[model samples]
Each structure stands twice: as C-alpha cells, then as structure tokens.
Target chain A: MVKSRRTKAGDIGIAAICLLLMIICLLPMLNVLARSLSSSQAIIRNEVLLWPKGWNLEAYKFVLTDSKYTWSLAWTAILTVICTFVSMVMTTLCAYPLIYRDLKGRRLFNTLILFTMYFNAGTIPHYLLYKDLGLLNHPLVLIIPNSLSVFYMIIMRTFFYSIPDSLRESAEIDGAGPIRILFSIYLPLSKPVLATLSLFYAVGRWNGFSDALMYMNNRTYHPIQLLLYNILNAITSIEIQTQEGFASAPGLSDTIQAATVMFATVPILLVYPWLQKYFISGATLGALKD
Target chain B: MKRSSAINRKRIANYLRKYWTLYLMLSIPLAYFVVFRYIPMTYVQIAFKKYSIVKSPWEMPWADNNGFEYFIKAFRNLDFLYALRNTLLLNFLDLVLGFPAPIILALLLNELPFPRFKRLTQSVAYLPHFLSWIIIAGLAKQLFAPTNGMINIALNRLGFESVPFLNDPVHWVFTYVFLGIWRNVGWNTIIYLAALTNINPELYEASAIDGANRWQNIRYITLPGLRPTIITLLILALGQILSSEFDRPFALTNPLVNSVSQVISIFVYRYGIRGLQFSLTTAVGLFQSLICVIFLMAANALAKRFGERGIW
Candidate 1:
C-alpha cells in the first residue's frame, strides 16, 4: 500500500520531467517561428517570445523572391534526389554481394570495406585527392566521393543476411541465378530497410555542408546548407560591427534569419513523422555495430 | 593426379562463371573506396614532404627537422595549441554533461506511465537532432542575442542582466555543449531504450516481490542490463575524442568565440585547404588521427580488462 503510493509519486515526477523536456524542445523553435513572423519593430523592441507580435510575411517574401536563395533550394532538392538514387544503387550493390557466404575473397573484401569505416585518411589527403581528381569547384565532388557509406552498407548487408538461407536455396534450386535471386527475392523483401536508408541518404545529402565548404570555391554551386552557413558567418561579422549596441544589417534582418532557418529546416521537419516511424528499427540495426 | 587436377579446374571454372555477376557488381563500390578512400592514405606522407607546385609532395625533399617539422610546428603554434586545448576542453565538457543526459532521460522515461505522452516527448525531442547545425545556430542567435534577444530581453524585463551567451568565450563553451546536448539527448535515448526493452520483466517482478523500490529495481536490473551497451558506446566515443564532426565547430562558431571554437578540423581547413600549408596541416591531421586510434585502442583494452564487451 505504501509502495503503491510511492510509485504514484515517482510516476508523477517522471511525467513532469517529460513535460518539461517537451517544452524545452518545443519553446525555442516556436520562438524562432514567432520571431520569423513578427514585425521588425516588435523584434527590435524585444516583444516576440513564443508568439508573434506585429506579424508580417516580408522576410519570407524577401527569401522566396531572392534568386540565390530560391535557386539553391531547388538545386538542393534535385541534388537530393540524384544523390539518393545513386547512393541506393551503390550501397545495395556493395551490400548484396557480400552476403554470399562462400563467395571468393569475401573475407578480404569485408576487411577492406570495414577498414574505411574506422580509419579515414583524414581531411588533408582527402582534399588533396579531390583536388588531384579535378573535382575541386565541381559539384560532382559532393556526389561521387560520399557515394558509398560503409556503415549504411553494413546495415543493408546485415538485413540481407537475416533473410533465411532456405529462401535463397529454393530460388537457386529453381535455376535462378544470383542476380535473379537478389531481384526477385532479396530486393522485393527488403523495401522497408531500403526506404529507411534512402530517407537517411536523402536527408544527409540535403543537409550536407562540410564537403562544399572544403572542396569548392564556387559560390553559385553552393547547396542550401552551405548557403545558410555563409549567411550565418556573414552575420557574425555584422554582429561584431554592431556589438556595442544592436545588430542591424541592411538586408539581413532578424526576421530574415529566422525565416531562412525555417526554410532550411522545414523540409527535414516535414519528414519527421516518417523519420519517427522508421528510425527506431534503423537505429537498432545501426546500433548492432556489426 | 592429372585427372584430379582437371576436375579441380572444372570446379573452379564453374564457381567463377556462376558468381561472375556478383564480382562485377562489387567493382563500382570497390573502385570508389580505392580511389576516394585508400589512395589518399598513401598521400599522408605529404606531411613529411615540402609543398611544391612544380613537383609532387613525394618528389619534394623531406621537410626541415628530419620530417618532424610540421608536427613540432603544430604543437608549438599558438592557434593550433588553442584549437587542441579547446577541442579537448569542449569534448570533455560534452563527455561530462552531454553523455549521461540520454541515459538519465531514458530512465526517467521508463518510469513515465503515459504511453502517448512518452511518444510525443520523444518525437519533439528528436526533432532538433534532425535540424542542421546551421539552423540551430540561427535559433541560438534568435533566443540568446543580447538586448533584442528573446531570452536576454525576458531576463531584463524580469530585472536581471542580459547574458552574453554567444559573445563570451567561457559562456560560449557551455552554450555550445548545451546546444549539443539539446540536439542529441533525445535521439541518443533510442539506443538505451532499445537496450531497456531487452531486460527481462521477470527481474522487475522478482524485485517487486522482494519489496524493492523503483530506485532499487532500476539500480539492480536496468543499469546492469545496460552496462555492456554503455561501455561499448563509451569506447567508440573515445575514438572520436580528437576527431569530431567538422560541421558543428565549423557552423556554430563565430569570430568572438573563435578562441574556444577553433577545433582540429577547423585548423586543418584554415591552414591546409585555405593557407595551402599542406605539410603542417597534414601533420596535424595525421597526429589527430593517430591519437584518435590510440585513444580508441586504449579505451577498448581498458574496457576488456574490466571484463566488458568493447566495440570490437
């Protein structure tokens, strides 16, 4: 009887913490949304918090109308699609063949592939190689170099390994070749894992900034994240200029920064429901670390 | 013997012919790994050679001081030292503050009775993890900006001083760590939560029968079940002690916070890529990588000595 009452107290305490976490997670983003919608007068006067004050859509209008911003958005969307398709094909190819237990040089291939996951040659050599390959300032630098993720490939290979051997054996007994077996049996059955990995690949490509930061000098080819990074860096310099009092860039307003963040963030945020649904299994699979 | 050799040849031929397509399929990814990944490893010797436009780094003579010039330079350079100090300091703080946040959250979450609220809390928390650091930086500027910043403004209205969250170096480090925790804590709980489900309900029932309180149940059953997962993750995380994701420091840092924010990756970007100081930067990179591997091995060995399953 005493224990039950104690348990109820514990439960309430836990619920309160969860509620606090939800608010912590929710409030700042709502603040960004509020700042983005509020008038510059109210924003400067420090009126906005969780809700808008003197609300307007001028920042969104400015961002949507700007060619540089809109072009990168569209360009990144296209890049995401291309990267996802190419990466899926590349990853599937890398993973499917390795599941053959009796394949020649399997151990060697596995060792070689897995080594890349742990030890990258670090950034200098990677950059130098990209420079030598004539990919510097080229957009293919992003797509080609990061084409195969050994981690994701391992996830796929493990998934492939889990499909029963008897399934493959029956396909082989029917005189289906390895390719036929992979397509008709393995590929068809592996849609959920494939979709999950594809979503990850797409989202990763969409958010990627570092490669472009390092490998390219071309501003026009910058993706949305890179664009935002440049904008953020530019604003820091402005903040230094105005640090004594207030930051007031001519075109880059507080509302505009908030709106830009929303634009960059919303696509991935829109994918959250699907990510919430898919990621638990994906997380568990990746967590296996096999 | 000749007839047996002929039969073996036929068997080899059949094996090769049957699985030829698989090998063909493997070649593309293998080629990518070779060209993009492995070949660069050999070029790490550039750290030892002199930079030249007319000759490759390999063709250039060994650098000053018998090939230890750049390593010494990196250690001695004030900016590099600052970066090293900041990297270790920031990551250590993250290790202290950021590491256990998820485990604690997961434990608290396990005690929560409402399934719907638990799911909603998790979904909301995980949302921030998916957003890019650039987006997070924007959010930070919005809330933490002085004077007009929402949080600072709120504080002022409440008769408190504005916090220099982004402007000051010491506060910057803590803010950076907090942002990191905010981004990762919820998402990280997924691993611990998954581990929690693997613990047997029978243990909980037995503990309850023995009159073990909730704290005691967790102390005995849940934590013990999570030990291997925790240790494995810790060992893996140690490998990344020197090499963090280049994105966060690169994105979240500003000129004011540069002293604290200039990590090794930023060092490499500034000197190697931008300054074209290939020898010095590659030495730093190699040194960073070597230390990372050492930390990883040392951590794994330590874990094994204590009879835990390390990541290996």
Candidate 2:
C-alpha cells in the first residue's frame, strides 16, 4: 500500500465525493424504510422524508398475512434453494474435469461452454424448448433451464486450477478416482470460492423473476420478486385513478408497496453481510481473471 | 497407417476406461448443453420457417424455399426499427456515460486516506447492486412518481412543477440511464479497485520522486496502469451494444413511454410470448443473436489487435 499524507486536498476531495455518492445511494433505500414504517396518510401526504411521520406495522402485517405475498415468498425461497444447489453441483462437475491437463476433449468442452457466452438461441427458442420439455409453468422451469451458468463455472474452474496438482495426484495414488478425489480433496479445499459461488447463485436465483413472469401463467406460482413487481404496478396504477376514495387512500398504497418491497428485499439483504467479504474478493479476482 | 490408427483407437479406449468417472461427471453438463443450448439453436431456424405452433419445430418449412418472408416483414415493420434504434441508442448512451462511472468511482475510492471509511462507503455503494430490478423499479417509482414522489415533492416544495420522470419519453430515458448507473456503478467498481490494487506502488513512488503532482501522477501512472482493464471492459461493453437489458427496461417501462422504451428484447417478449407470433419474434431474436456474434467477434479482434486479452 502506498503511504500518503493525512488530510491532503486530494484525500478530502475523494472522501467528500464518495460520501456524497454514498448518501445518494443510501437515501432512496432509507426513504423506503421510513415510508414503510410511516402511516399511510403521512406517506400519501408526502409528510415522511427520512423519518417516519407516524409509526405503524400495519403495512408489514398486511404483507405477512396476505396469501399472495406468503405463497410467492415460499415459492421464491424453494426455487432459490433448489436452483443454487443444482447450479453449484453442475458448475463443480463441469469445472472439475476441465482442470485436469490430460483430460481428453477438455478444449472442446471449454469451447462449447465459452461459445454460449457470446451467442445463444435467444429467448423465444429457449422458451419454446422449455415449453416442449414440460418445464413451462412447472417449478423446475426456474431451476433446470438455468442450472449451469458458464460464467460461474469458469470462476469455479479458475479457483480449482489454483489448487495444487500434488493434492490431486496424491489422492489418485491412493486409489481415489476423479469423483472421489474431487469430493474428498477439492471440495474441502474450496470453501471460500464455494461460499462465494453459493451466495452468487442464491442471490441471482432469488432476485430473478423473468422466468416466473414468462413461464408461469398462474398467479399462485409467481415468485416473490414478481409479486413485488405486481404490487408496485398496483401502486403506480393507483396514480391514474381520480376517484375520491382513492385520492384519499393513496397513502396506504404507498406504505403497503414500501412494506412489500422491504418484505421482499430484507431477507436477501440479511444474507448479504454474511458473504459480502467473500463476495467482494470473489468478484474482484473472478473479473480480473476473466 | 492402418495399424497405427488401430493402436491409437485402443489407446483411446484404455484412457477412457481409466478416467471414465471424469467423463461421467462431464456427460451431465454435455447433455445439459445439448438439451438446453443446442436444441434452442435448432429452434432458431423457425425464424426462417413458416412456423406453426401445432407442428413440431423440425416440421416447419425451411426459409430458403420461402423463409425470408418474415425477415422482410421484420425489416418493413416500423416498430422493429424503432426497437432496434432504441436498443442501440440506449446501449450506446450507457457505453459512453455509464462505462466510465465505475472506473472514476474506483479511482476516487482509491484516493481515500482512511481504509475503514473507504470500506464502509464501498459496501454502501455496492448495496444497490444486490437489489433486483423489481425492487429497484419499485424504489424508483416511489422516488420519481409525478404527483407524490419524493423528488416531485421536493420540486413542489421549491415551487416548481413536478417532472414527469416516468411519463415523459425523454425524461424516462434519462431516468433509465441514471438508474442503470445508480444500481451498477458501485458493483462495477470492485473489478477496477482490484485492478488498482494490482498496480505497482514503486511506480507511483518514482513519479512522486520526479516531482510529479497528484494529478500528474494519476494521469501518467494510474491511468496507464488501468489502460488494459479499461480496454478489456470496453470491448466487453461493445459486445453488449445490442442487448438493451431486459429486466431494467421491462420493470421500469410504462405504456405511456413504450414508444421510447420498447427495446428489441421487449419486442421479442411482446411478439413471441404475448402476441404468440413465433416466427416473427424468432426472426428478431435470430437477428439479434447474429448481430451480437458479429459484435463479439469484432470486439475480440480489437482487443487482440491492441495486445490485450480477448474474452475468448
């Protein structure tokens, strides 16, 4: 690290800019929090700024007890878990063989996977294919179709490459097969990268709702993100109405939407702090190597 | 030659037996690619075919016999052109403006004297990146709503008219671009900060010794250090010039701004999924994929020409 004088003009300037940007970044999110906690009337009146004008959990109560929100949340949680598990397994399996220098057809497999990054069959065909495969409207639609992200596979592969050859060789010498060696040795040694990838997969699967939107026609099958999206639409659509009741009721809609947004967001946010350090390092190193 | 070929075949068989488990592990991914990736590629031919939902994709008549019809139709469609233009324009705007944001943020963050403050700020900045476009869109709608949005409220407080951030076409694009930067700039900085850490400190020391001021040192040393990374990312960004992102656009777009916001991906969704016009939309999707491939190849070539790492 380069040593620098304290309180230099450059330092002050950089810190100030960073701080200002941070506030800009944080303010909207914080405002949502404040709005969610504030009374519906305060929200509609635009009385709440960064602080709650009237504190209440009525909106939160609505979100938690609502059947639509709860069902979608359950689907999203299950989908995230299954998708992450399948993705991690496939990524590991795909990345492992490619690490071996003597693995036949390694270049062919790598090229096949890499080709996908630049080109695809596009959305329509993928949708049609999924439809044909009986994946449409099914929970597996979210999991199987996107199970192997080539980018994450490459990240994991790079991590596997950094592992010493001697470990694998020794394991093999003791009669460990590739599967055995991978299970007993490689997976044990790859905790940080695995955790990083698990978080990536989990977060990605959790936030992703396009699949649900496209594939599932049943509102009951909608994921939490899609539910939140619909809820937001309700909030925005409320703007078009000029009815006297709605005019008086705009605040409740704001608080309800804000509460739903937080309900969808806070669970994922809770997971972030646990894996953030690994996520940072993983992202940085992965991008550099890429 | 015949005898050597037999021996080579036998050697291959022996090698397969020894590492059969590895191949077994790989077979799953290979099968996955074939089923999910390659099969969809075959379906792309439907773009050229007289596609019928009732018929299997393979049963559709090929384009050369009469298939360029949809392609011609797509070209003639004014909406398609608009979508293409909007896609290219939005992506280009992002490339020009949004691309440099993270690099600048990373550089500024690097200049901070206190590590603790820097780390805290970085974490806060990265927070938005984790949010889904759905949540971001919700937050954006709340913040920019014409009547009661926080920004509008502030404007009204200052005795100004509420800006139609979501309704107005031009202002919508501005909001789209700003939101894109807001959500991603911090996350994008991680790579650049990593690149910053890789720069040799001694070079900076040498520059300081030569009486180079901070700006001069940054210009000559830091900028040069970041050149490869900047070029690599720019090349990657160029490849995505046609891919006006689906999530952000889809979530944020309103019926009022559909003219400006109806991008290629959205067009695909409209025609393919909702309109149920498989052939027309597939043609559009194929056209997009072709352009994307061309862009990727061109970018990779440029990177290679500059002696930087090509993505391939």
Candidate 3:
C-alpha cells in the first residue's frame, strides 16, 4: 500500500526549492557568460541581465590576442600536465608498494606519509624550506614539493588491496617480479582510479595560485589563476606593465574581466565531464570507508 | 654458532634478492617525504630564533626571552590576535551555515519524484565545486559589485538602494559564506547520498506497512542512518577550527573588507612574504599548526567519549 503518498503541494515545494538552488548556482555563471558576449557599453549601463545586449566577441578577441594572457595560459597548461604526471607516478610509487603484506617497513612508511595529512609544519617553515633549497621563484617548486598527496595514495592503495591476491600470487609463481607484476597487472587494471587522480592533480595544478603568489615574483612564472587574481584585484603596482592585459586592454574593464574569467575557467570546464564521471565514486569510496 | 650465522645471512640475502625492485621503487618517494615533508618540520626552529635571510635558520641566534620571544610577541600583538580570532570565526561561520546545506540538499533530492530531473539538478549543482575560487570570485565581482553589478543594477531599477554585496566588510562575510556553501554543498552530499543508499529499503517497507507517513519515515529511519556520518564529519571539521583555505577569502576580499578578511593565512602571507618578518611569521604559523593538532585530538577524544566512532 502507498501509505505515504506525497501531496501535490509538497512535491511542488520540493521542485521549487531544487530549481531555486540550481538557479543560484547557475545564474552567476550565466551572467558572466552574457556579460562577456555583450558590449562593454551595455554592461556599464547595466542593460545586460542573463542575456546579451549588443553582443560582440571583442572581449574574447582581446583575451586571446594578449600575449600576457596567452603566456599565462601556456604556463598553467604546462604546469598541469607536468604536475599531473609527476604526482601520478609519485602517488603510485608510494601506494603500490604498500599493497603487499610482505613488504618490509610498510607500516612505518604508511605512518610517515599519512601523518602529514592531518598536520604539517604549516606555511612559514615550508616557505623557509623552499627558500633554503633555492626553490623561490623556481618552477620546479610547484611540481616537486607537492608531487605526492598521501590521501590519493591511500585511495590507490585501497583499490590495489581490493584486487585478488591470487592474481599477484599466480604471477609471482610464474616468476613475475614486483615491478613486472605492477606493470602488467595493477597498472592495466586500475585505469579508473588513475584517471580520476590525474584529473584531481591536473585541476589542482591548474588552479594553483597561492604557491605561485608566495614563491614566484617573476611575471613569466605566473599561472593563469595568478594572472586572473592580479587582474581582478587590479594591483596598481603593475598597471602600466599589464594595462593591456587587463579587461580588453581598454576602458570599462568589466566585460573584459568576464571574458578573461571565461578564458581562465573553460580549460577546466572542458575536462570536467571526465572528472565528474569518476570523482563521485572515487570520493565516496574514500570518504565513507576510510 | 657459525652455521647459524651463515644461515641467517643467507636468509637476508634471499629476502633482498626477491624484494630489491620494491625497495628501489620505494626509495625515491621515501626520500621525497624526508626532504619535502619532514625537513620542513625541522625548520620550525626558525620560530624560536632571530632568523634572517642573510643566514641559515640553523645559525640564527636564540631569540630574546629564551627562545619564547617570537611566540610571546605574536601572542602579545593585537593584529596577530585579531587574525587568529577572525580565522576561527570565519571557519565557525562556514561550519555553522555551510555544513548543513549538503545534508538538506541531499534529503530534498531523495524526495524528488523524478530521477531525470534530480540527476540534472545534481550535475548542475556539482559544476560550481569544480571551478577555482579565482573564477568564482571573479564572477562575483561582476555579479555583486555595488554600483555596476547586475544585481545592484536590478535593485536600482526596482527603486531600491544598491547593496555592497562584496566590497563592504559585513556584506562580504555573508557573500563569503554564501559562496563557500554554494561551492561545496552539492559535492559534500556525495557521502550522505552514499550513506542513504546503505539504509535498508526493507525498513521503509515495514514502516509503510505500519502506516507511517513520509515525514515519519524520514525522521525515524533516514536521519538515524545519517547520524554517524554527520557526527564524524562535524568532529573532523572541528579539528580544522583554526585552518582556512587561503584562496577563498584571498581571492574574494577587497581592500574595503580587510577588517574581516585579515585571517591567519593572509596574515602570514603578508608578514612573511611582503614584510619579510621571518621570525614572527614562523612563530604564528607554528602556533596555528599546534592549535590545529590540539583541536583535532580534542575533537576526536570528545567524539569517542560520547561513543561515536571518530576518525582515529
């Protein structure tokens, strides 16, 4: 029996609430998109809402043509790729070995790595360490220092633990060494986790700004997000050098700001579908059990 | 004895022969942890010393007040204390206002009559979580700016005064918390949704047979199912009482909101990075880290004393 049949009023209320939430999240983005497509004059006059008025592609053109914007995008992309690769390798190296029960010092290794997740030396010491190691203003500072995340490593390890030990044991019986077993068996089988983690690392590296902000003063080393931050904040210190790079390189920079925001964001938005597919399960699995 | 020693040596050799590649693979990461993670811990000594860029932290003279000078100074400084309070306040606001949004969203989602619409809503909801703070904050500048922003422009058209949704101190707090909730609430629902699935449907069936209403079923069954998760997450959140992401506020905050936005992380960035107050900044950083640890342990202990399975 349908003892608790929902009323029409309650259903409408729920639907309305859900729609409101969706709108709240979507409106800002749509507003930005509309503003970017609209004329700068329309934006200044507040004529544009969620739809464009006197639409033009000038903001996009300006963003694309600016060498400063182009270079920051290029560096961010490069950083994303390199950090993703290095992080995956390092995460794998830290994770894969821990799956074996017989691996010596596995407990100690696990403790040392996992402890840093909860607590660390915090910002200044890490900064001083970077300084001591000559990493200030260095590109490798981003790539190398944070190459491995213990949390992702644990997820990979958990996935590895789920695979049947008999498969590995059979390989060992056939004389497949540890490295060989990993290459032939684990690597090929664990594609989903690997992909999810790669997206995490890539997005992380792409959006990284505080590191570049703190460590990098060299304009050449700044990522897209850092450049976006500077532009949004309108740091007057670099206005002369970067005026052309900001908001269509001209007057009424709001439209150009929206366009620049779009330019900085669309890269991640492109890869987001792939991320959404794997991240839900990967995150739940990590969160619920462990 | 000689024969026994030879046998032990042979066993060690055999073990190495079998596991040499594993050891080789482990060495690089082990070295990485030691250098990148652990070495920084040793540098916390800078907080205790009169450190300068001219000399290594190791060679710095002991700070006046017998290595407690910087810590005392940080504690004494009103600016430092203000930032510390602001850090906790902001995080508390996020914890109070931002944490429950996901749970409510998940519950409403469960109540939805249609799966397709629910799925679409969820996908859209998850979209903002993926965008960086820079992107979100950038959008806010356009959408919420006092004079030229679309919202304010609409308010003016409606004959209402424009609101400083972002550029003002008090209004910025609301916007900050709102954006923080908007960004993470949907994504956070994943765990609760997963937990919801694990709630046995048979209980709902039995309750239905007993003529329970939808509200009763949810109040009795669904909520109890979600209790452990909520508590665990809350405890974990409490452990992070002093820590805030430098990005969220830093990205959104303007000069006008400095009174509220001068959090501990931003404070460190300014002093250590811009002002080059190496010793003082390190002391502050160390203080924040230690408090985080203490809060985590205390939260975990409190949870366990109350008979919840805390994240040990």
- Give each prediction's DockQ, rounded to 2 decimals: 0.74, 0.74, 0.77
- Classify candidate 1 by CAPRI docking class: medium
RMSD of 3: 1.9
Candidate 2, B272-300: lDDT as tens digits:
89888888999999898888889978998
Measured on C-alpha atoms, candidate 3 has an lDDT of 0.86
Please write out the lDDT profile of model 3 over residues B63-158, one tens digit for every residue. Answer: 999999999999898888889888888899999998888999999998887798998888889888888999999999889977778899889999
Model 3, residue pairs in steric clash: none
The interface RMSD value for candidate 2 stands at 1.2
- Provide the lDDT at B54 for model 3: 83
Candidate 1 residue-wise lDDT, B98-161, digit = tens: 8889999989888887999888888888888788888888889888988888889889999999
**Alpha carbon RMSD to native, model 1:** 2.8
Query: How much lDDT does each candidate structure score?
Result: 0.85, 0.85, 0.86
Model 3: how far residue A136 lies from native, Å: 1.3
Q: Give candidate 2 regions above 4 Å deviation.
A: A1-7, A235-251, B1-14, B63-66
Recovered native contacts, candidate 2: 0.80
Q: Candidate 2 vs candidate 3: which has greater TM-score?
A: 3
